[model samples]
Target: MKKDLVKIIEDALKTLGIEKPTHIEIEIPQNESFGDMATPVAMILAATLKKPPKKIAEELVNAIKDKSVFEKIDIAGPGFINFTFSKKYIYSEIKKLMKDKSKFLREDIGKGKRVQIEFISANPTGPLHLGHGRGAATGAALSNLLEAAGYKVDREYYINDAGKQVRILGLSVFARYQQLLGRDYPFPEEGYRGGYIEEIARVLIKEEGEKYLKRAFDEVSDFFTDYSYKRMLSSIDSDLKDFGIAFDTWQSEKELYKKGDVEKALDDLKNRGLIYEKDGAAWFKSTAFGDDKDRVIIKQDGEYTYFTSDIAYHRQKVEKKYDEIIDIWGADHHGYITRVKAVIEAIGYPKEKLKILLVQMVTLLRGRKPVQMSKRAGKFITLREVIDEVGTDTTKFIFLTRRPDSHLEFDLEAAKAQSSENPVFYVQYANARINSIFAHAREKGIDTDMLYNADLKLLSVHEELRIIRKLLTYPMIFEGAVNAHEPHRITFYLQELSGMFHPYYNKYRVITEKSEQSRARLALCEAIRIVLQDGLEILGISIPEKM
Candidate 1:
């Protein structure tokens, strides 16, 4: 409906002999007094036409004399033109929603293009911490949003199993293994010290038997590291699945090394004159493409750096024929974005084809104080622990309540509290309440069959109009989320929309006073229920039929 109104305004401007602007932006007014829909096109064009904004707005108002759909048009503060559509039009929109609720909100802008979103990609050094959980929730929701927008989307988690971190994890586990066998060994200070390391060591000891303990420490460490890396990856995968995140691909860095892609990537860069030796180390000339300094791809010890494997992984993504690639990384890695884009540019791919989303850190809070997270002290919170304390839905929703680039505070008390204070419960309660209305309507023999046959023109209450107006905003919300590549916007939208419904329910009764008005309002309620269900489903949140 908003798009339709914009077209009408554009045509009205052309018909009035006022040169139509090249573009126009239409938005819902923040203040209800402004009107249902507002536009600043006249103010934007006044400078070019050498006319005052109000005068231009007057001309626009006069040009759009067709009062068929619009009930009123007013020029408010600063030449803002606001339009209030007729209640009849509002009813018509509700009817349209009732007729085509399933397909009303989705758009075909992506046209089935292949897009891969890789996120969290945390090394299997320890259990996933609070930060990894944030990335997982954000990436999973993003993949669902892209699919809703008509794209063929793939959610992927890259396991960093062939890195220094995995080696550290192995040493950490081997240290525990030897200690269990009554041997004294000094663990590396940089090695992982999480309590889970002991569990991994115990498992390895049980599986490999005592014969393996007789081997040299270095040999045992090598065997344990390989074994621990694979086991940790499996555990991470299972935890993510339990958290309602399922990845379509589990790409491994070890697989890249095994397939010789890492060596090939280095050779290609060297042949292209993009790599050179300096200080007995091979460095990539990333500065040629806007990096602050040339980065060493291979160190003096003849070992490949993390950046070497990353370049090969990106090349592998491009080889898979993905039209676009999105990488979700922590905010601490913001500086790496430039270098990664530089590598893509050097590899003959447009910089725009690859996009990096940096997610800010999440701070767990108990009230006013920040919860300390330290892996070395063995006092960090894992993603599994958060889910164990709060269910998956609450955990996922809280993680997505804030923007990916902003600091988030996860309060365990607030999330677990089963009251209106919990945003997830509030939203879910709205869905449940809507479903409850349908059950009551069924008991009263007031189903869709009866409502469809009744006159919908009777839905003229102010609360009914407001609910319909909020329902009409779904398409705009969907479009904004897709354009911004931000799934948290949907979470915020659901909260607001659900808040609107709760008040509407409190003020008016859906199944009371069996008049034509009651039937019409019930129809409106049904439409809202469908939309709420659809929106929550897109975010991977369950809409319970009952609380």
Candidate 2:
């Protein structure tokens, strides 16, 4: 619908001997009395074209060729052209929407561009905490949103298997295993202290018994580290799966080292004169690309810094030919963005092609008081525990209720409520209520499907037309959300659409004594259901047909 309107306006400008701007902004009039859609193109072109704004508006209105698309084009105030869409046009669009949702709702905003989004690549040291859960939910919804907008997206998770964190996890399990076997070995000073460690120890005892009791720690360190992390990673995969997030790629940090990509990337930087030797250590000239100072890529002890592997990983991602690379990191990693983008620039990739989003930490509360400590994790709450307590739908919906970069206070009782306070319940109930309407229509021997052919012009009441007006603006909302890479927009939109429908439903009946009125209203209700379910699906939330 927007595309058609833009074309009409462009053609009108061509007739007036004016070259259109690259983007002619179309807006929905906040005051319904203005029109359905309004554009300030005349106001924008006035000073440059050397014509009065009202005269230009009049000339464009007189020049419009697609007269059937509008009921009337009025010049209000100084030069604003307000367009009220003809009822015939609105009926055609609503009919097309009810006939086929997929072809109607899917916009071509991406135009086949490929995007690589890497997120929630948490260390395999323990269960995923709430912070990780927020990233997971955002990543999953962003992937769905891009796909709906016609982009080919690769959802990825980078495994941090080549770090000290995983080694500590191995030592923790190794120490716990020895103790469970009656050995007197000491635990690592900074080992993880969660109850999950003891569970891993029991599993190792049940499987291997005292097989490693007589071996030196260094001799069997690889086996213990590999077994322990792999176990933790399995649980991670399961938890994410239950949360409705599955990644297309699992790039391993260890694989980057094993394949010599890290060494090759460092050599590339050195060849480009971005690497320098300082005090027997190799330093990267990150400041050359906007960093506050240069950073060390290799220490004097000949060990690679954490940033070294990150450079290799991003270099590899660029080689995959994705048009855009997106990294979703936590707020704690705020300062890390500039340095990472600097390495990408040093490696000859455009820094702007790399987009990084930071998700703020989540604060869990029971009503107003803060709830701390998880019985299972022994330190912080686990994503799995939250899912087990509330539900998969509530956990996901609550995480997405706020912008990922903003602080979110998730109330446990509010999320579990069955009333409108629970957003998930509110949105889900809208679809369920629509189903009941159709069921009631059938019980009265009124076929709702046949209403699709009804004279929808009978939907002339203020409230019915108001719902239609709101329903037709979905594409604009979707385009804005997609271009901004924000999925919380969809959550907020679903709530508003449901909010509109629930009040209207309480006062109106879908199956009335007047056959024509009932038919037109039933068609309106079905369109609302289609759009509500469509937005919910983009957020990856379930649509319940019954409360």
What is the C-alpha lDDT profile of model 2 across 314-427, one tens digit per residue?
999988889988999999999999999998888888899799999997888877778886533458778898888788888899888788889888777766663356788888
What clash count does candidate 1 reach?
0
In candidate 1, position 275 carries an lDDT of: 98
Q: TM-score of the candidate numbered 2?
A: 0.94
Best by TM-score: 1
Compared with the true structure, what per-residue lDDT tens digits does model 1 show for residues 309-367? 99999888887889889999999999899899888888888888899999998889765
Clash totals in order: 0, 0
Q: Where is the poorest 10-residue window by lDDT in model 2?
A: 412-421
Clashing pairs in 2: none
* Cα TM-score per model: 0.95, 0.94
Task: Tell me how far the alpha carbon of residue 48 in candidate 1 is from the true structure, in angstroms, after superposition.
Answer: 1.4
Tell me, what's the RMSD of every candidate?
Answer: 2.0, 2.3
How well does candidate 1 score on lDDT at residue 168? Answer: 85
